[model samples]
Target: MQKTFSEKILAKYSGKSHVVPGEIVEVIPDIAMSHDNTAAISKTFAKIGVDKLYNPDIHLVVLDHCVPPANEAFAQNHKDIREFVKKHGIKKFYDINNGICHQVMAENGHCLPGTIMTGSDSHSTTYGAFGAFGTGVTRSETAVIMATGKIWFRVPETMRINITGEFQDGVYVKDLALGIIGKIRADGALYMAVEFTGPAAGKFTVSERMTLCNLAVEMGAKVGYVPPDEVIFNYLEGRAAAEYEPVYSDEGCNYDAVVDMNLSELEPVVACPHTVDNVKPVTEVAGETIEQVFVGTCNNSRLDDLAILAHVLKGRHIDSSTRLVVIPASSKVMIDAMRLGYIETIVSAGGTLATPGCGPCMGNHLGVPATGEKTISTANRNFKGRMGNRESEVFLASPHTCAVSAVTGKISDPREIPVDMALIFSELRKATLSPVLMTR
Candidate 1:
């Protein structure tokens, strides 16, 4: 039988370097991540007659969820994780202060192209941002790989999503992801690998592209990828670059599905409460007063994202009815934002800046929306009770949208904001068009 392109990439990474279905690949994981939510899984591994961890160096544990643990049970879980990391000599323990595991891992170069990765959290798929074949597993499964240096994957069919057209001002990667998800549905790409390609994706910065691929599992995808280009190499080079070849899908690779997106006429999008796939243009729900607006998290905490927000809210103050909270993804991001005057600008404009960490979004550490309140955020999930109050409603949007929401006290469309978004986009285009053309 003729081998498919995806099969070829997996084959090279497989222990034997050959194409075979249902065969467990044994490649080394470039990175592994876990959080307090899955801390119990680490205990389960110990109970299964596993005394020592597989690869202490490769294991990365985060203390995100249960930050100030909601209750005794959650607090104990974090405590257990701490003891385990200490006992195993795990050197990569990021306490609650380290921000979100996914952001920290990628920004710090823990995951890179062609590397295999696993994490206990379902969002582990976020590492696909680095062009790695990454996914989630049970804590025990993760532990076994930590020891055995291998894991299994059921070869999945591939889907190629080509995004084209120019983007409207104020729209961002988050909007594109929501647009894609709305079209594809929660299970639209079920049991498949989604490979985003073409001009639009190429226009995105590495972090923006990462934000898109990180949500692969939201549509039931097994994995998501972007072919390694200069953006990928630049982010990887001089950080964690190595002398190794990466396998790419053949030029004529077979695709189980194909989606063509033309975002030229697109507007900022929002995912309504309780479902990421329930996407609608921001205009549809704008002006509905909001109680809280959160900006930060592993999914949308890049400097570029913050810069965009700063530009949007440079002279505006939060709406009297809305409380805006900004949490950087890491200590580094916070420090840099402060050094660049973004932090001061945000604070003086009535935004409360938090330390570098994942709490507001996690619902365990930072501000929790009051019951029945409405919230807007730049975080990944907008599922029920995702950010603390079960009765509260959460809408997902880009940092630009979230920032404007803070000022308007409602879900906002960036294009409608007082900011000069059109000029912003025009200048952005001129400044970036040259480099993109050069690269091509």
Candidate 2:
């Protein structure tokens, strides 16, 4: 006789005050985000003749994507947008040197639990790390949210992912995410709200949680939510994020389905070339050589990640056959690492370091591999032509794995280099990682 938790949340978002998932309910969106990727979005929004953004204070304009813009012209391209944002009275623009769009908003606490939010970027779903429902919408849709605090949503069916067991050495959150993508496929979860359950997701950090939900859109998920808990509360308290009564579904709240998983023996993993869903344990794909190892991206370049690679490369040099590239997620991350001597270790070991920007990942600048060259990355996404070269082969792994691969030239696993990687791991475990970017 009673509705499930999913049914309740869906109904409220869909439109009705009563339990309804498909009602067109209006919520005063407390937060929203936009960035350079949508620089042209405004022009498109005007095509439909929308005069203003939903609510200026609730909008954040992040400039992380092409920051320190590659060329003088593109840099100017963003400059124009900066001027426009100012004209539009946008107050929360990150500009260059701030950080990634998703990273900044998530870190600063624009996201609150149990609210619906929207952004122009597909990865906007990353806000689910805090149990909020966020999704990527078209620029016009984003503009509509900008013009009106409310947007539309049809209550989506929910899917439960359950994981039990501990991850083995060298595997990190990315691998787990890729594993889920592999199981769900690119479109398997279309229009659904993905609620990660089970022990494994619970063991993840706020940063890791962001990484998991960030990729939800890749599977066509409408949103990705993790119920509130101590981790969520701890991350939000003392930060710029909104103060909300921590909300979560009761333990007895209904779920669409329960997924039980045991991840005890999970090994270092890779989401193979061409697809994020092509997952295979690193052990199964070992001996695969690579020509480059990249460390850093908005999705993976946290202090903890840098520390992990710093440990792996402490005394080891990059292999002659492999080139190592590291781009700090933002100026703060770069500056912080430099302040702590992590950057020194990374560079002294023959690792090539670049300023904070999305270079290699965009394939526009940086180490664009030659045809047939195998590359390993710590960043998210590995589609063909994604990294500047059309035929370059890419492999995705954790920072530890990326560093180890650089040391050995091939796709090396950090676990195999224990002597050189132990202290780093120990240090990483004790390091205090915080969000370096300003987010909603």
In terms of TM-score, the best-performing candidate is 2
Instruction: List residue ranges in candidate 1 displaced over 4 A.
Output: 1-6, 16-28, 66-76, 241-244, 418-440
Number of the top-ranking candidate, with lDDT as the measure: 1
CA RMSD per model (angstroms) = 3.9, 3.4
The window of 10 residues in a row where model 1 has the poorest summed lDDT is 431-440
What is candidate 1's lDDT per residue for 1-440, written digit by digit as tens? 45544577677767455655455555566566778744666656666675776678878887766455668987788888888889889888888666677777765667777667788777677766667777877777776665665666777788889989877667677888888899998899887878888887776666677688777888888777877667767766655634435556777766778999887866788999899999998889988889988888777876656656777678878889889888877666666566656678788889887766676775776778999898888887888988877899988899888888888888877876645644434433333211111121
Lowest lDDT sum, 10 consecutive residues, model 2, at: 431-440
lDDT per model vs. reference: 0.74, 0.73
Q: How well is each residue in 214-247 modelled by candidate 2, as lDDT tens digits?
A: 8788777888877767677767778745667434
- Report how far off residue 3 is in candidate 1 (Å): 5.6
